[model samples]
Target: MGLKSFLSRPLAAYTVRQYQQWTRQPELAQQRILQTLVRQGRATAFGRDHGLGGVRNAQEFQQRVPVRDYEGLSPYFDRVKQGESSVLWPGQPLYLAKTSGTTSGTKYIPITKDSIGNHINGAKDALLHYVHASGKPQFLDGKLMFLSGSPELEEVGGIKTGRLSGISNHHVPAYLRRNQLPSYPTNIIEDWEQKLDRVVDETLDQPMTLISGIPPWVQMYFDRITQRTGRPVGEVFPAFQLFVYGGVNFEPYRRKLLESIGRTVDTVELFPASEGFFAFQDEPHNPGMLLLADAGIYYEFIPAEQFYEPNPPRLTLAEVELDRNYALVVSSNAGLWGYSVGDTVRFVSLRPHRVVVTGRIKHFLSAFGEHVIGEEVEQTLREALQQFPEAEVVEFTVAPRVSEAETEPSRHEWLVEFARPPQDLAAFAAALDAGLRRRNVYYDDLLAGNILAPLLLTPLPAGAFQRYMRSQGKLGGQNKVPRLSNDRALAGGLLSVG
Candidate 1:
């Protein structure tokens, strides 16, 4: 073993043990976190305005501070933007993580000194866990690459501001930073297409032991390399053994990614975001990510089915049950109080509090009362792929196309871009319909009653979705096409481009 791996093993073992100890008492740890947050919040301007002076527990906190998204809390954020101290947190924030989403146009999330460790250490601990479990830590020896946002940050109110990935770029540990790839100049290129070409040029022949990014962008990089060299990524870089991915589920892009690799490589899943790092896959076989209970963030859950209800029951970790979908709400040291992160998660294991990202709170197909979420669609597609091994999807989205006639019912429209189109399109569509019926009862019911016809599958030409994103100026590592939407806007957009 090299000095790095040799030293990492013992440290990994100790860290994992310590983490396991706290995970065993999740509620206790969370309660302690709540107390700290409440104590510190009393000193903030927003907290004082929200009647947080007497808040002692969850109920009181909830009553004093209602759940708010970016728009609802923009008043306080505006103050922070103008360099106001003690607006949200005690002092001025260390950085502002600027992110753009489909719903919230642009949001500047604060990341303070108290919360920065969660962002950095969460990633480090995940890799260390892999080092301990896999027992093959040579990934540290070669060039470790994180295809992320630019390290070039602009100043906002005397605070560094940029994408969360970019903010993370500035804080990579020195040991790994020495081995990071694509050079600083290549990463700062604003145009994704140009940056990707430069990335291909710089790392085509390097010893890439690990490649980390959102899945779609990583697939794009692999495509570029294979197109140039006529060799699979595995052959191109024999040392590449680990792929770390976040921001989206990996299953939709998994088959194509593995085919490009031409071999199996271990993967690690993370649940990091600009708000805070929430979870990471702790065990090799466990599909669910272990929730970071002791981190600077305090987590709450609202049942997903009732998310739109006026007063939904908010539950703590101890009150949560298994296999139920819930919207994630969090209070953190970053000055976000009762903040809705807009993510839906399902708990698969309560003992260690492991969760799977079900979907986005707003990104669903509920137009016809058949609320089909992200995880369901992704899983259904995975099943459908089994029947047609020749077909590999590049990207896809679903939206309901309502009928103009009163008697004629609408159908779900599926716009799929394939890396390799299936030979029999009708057969592929039937397979998808069958799989979705097995997973979602409401969608199945609609078909049974003739309220909805079989989903229409439009095999889009390759690069169609990428073109749409480019047109919107959102083609990059940080942006992705929504898996499914409720309205015809995205569907119309995709069809218009094709």
Candidate 2:
């Protein structure tokens, strides 16, 4: 038997057991996770200060701890960075996962020993679940490539520090490491362009069966490979069967990626952040990802509309309703206590609790009091693209263009880089404007009242956003273009790149 087959027997059994507990008894599993976190952390400074010692249940835990963002937890992080122990968790973190400053500025998230276990195990279960669902026990025999950040970690205040991908690489198990591609030397190359070139060169001839990475970077890899080999990805690696991706919405890139591959492959989406691995596409056919309720994190959801309120209502899994946007909060083994990861989500299923990430809390255009979210903008583009079937959007960003004088009205400005330019630019823009108005009531009202002009569309040269991100040294791996911004800073920067 092959290595994968030998390992699958036990892994499959374990996955089945865990799946039952998660789906059949979600509340009980969540309660156990909460009690474990509280009991283990009760001795820490954060625990004592937040009355974790007395937090015996979910209700008590909620009443004691207030929801906070990275800024709110900065004071505690500052102390932890200075080499303090037992501040948030039982001891100092194993390393700090330095997140991409795409949304807010850079954040150093704690990655405790316990937290890393959750990440590793959660990933394992996701893959195992895929194997179980597909009934493809030999999926692991062929080479698997993870196009991720550098594995070379640097020391910051005596603690190891690097991107979350790098940190996870440091902990990759020996058995799985044998099947993973692009040697360790190639992984540690800090320069993204240099690393991509090397990875393409090294992995082109391998029997790659599975690939995982953020969509944009994976698209870049596919482009490079096609250029180098003069063949479609599936033609180069016929054994390739699965594509695992996360960190960004897959809608815009879905058609492009599938076209590049030249065949339909099984896909699994993940919701992993610096704080924790929160959810994964458990079933291949399911639309929403199954939340990892027992994955060492206690989750809370606040209605997106009330997220900015002084004291927003925090709801547990049972309290959340379907189709309502919510800002997710978590208390985890990673030392993040009631921390808002900043992304918003909507529940599609309540029984097993599946969710789809809607957008970022800070990524919205509300310059003219017409709040436009990422979901609305993306859906609008999707509709607009449908009208121009030949066109494909490479990347896009939206910002407000405020009036320079009273004669003009403020309007939403879109900078879109298309791989395949539409036949009619004006029609595409009109479709986008109409679609946006249809999606958002406030935007419709503003258009009707003449408070805001029709949305402006500017076609950017291809690779504009890529060039901008490269200049910012955030070209790949959890770094993405902010879809909606209140100001023109990002849009201006991308336009300035000739």
What is the C-alpha lDDT profile of model 1 across 1-498, one tens digit per residue?
678878888999999999988988999999999999988988899878987889888889888888888888999999999999999989999999998856668889999999999999999999999998888888888899899988889999888899899889889988778899979999999999999999999999899999999999999999999999999999999999999999999999999999999999999999998999999998866889999999989999999999999999899999999999999999999999999999999999988899999889989898899899999999989898888999899999998889999876699988999888788999999999999999999999999999899999988877889889998888986897888887888878877887
Global lDDT scores for all candidate models: 0.91, 0.88
In the order shown, what is each candidate's alpha-carbon RMSD?
A: 1.1, 1.5
The TM-score values for the models, in the order shown, are 0.98, 0.97
Minimal lDDT window, size 10, model 2: 98-107
With candidate 2 superimposed using the best TM-score fit, by how many Å does residue 498's alpha carbon deviate from the native? 3.3
Number of the top-ranking candidate, with lDDT as the measure: 1
Give the per-residue lDDT of model 2 (tens digit) for 386-448: 889999988998999999999877898999999998999889999999999898999999999
In candidate 2, the residue pairs with backbone N, CA or C atoms under 3 Å apart (3 or more residues apart, or in different chains) clash, namely none
Error of 1 at 445 (Å): 1.8
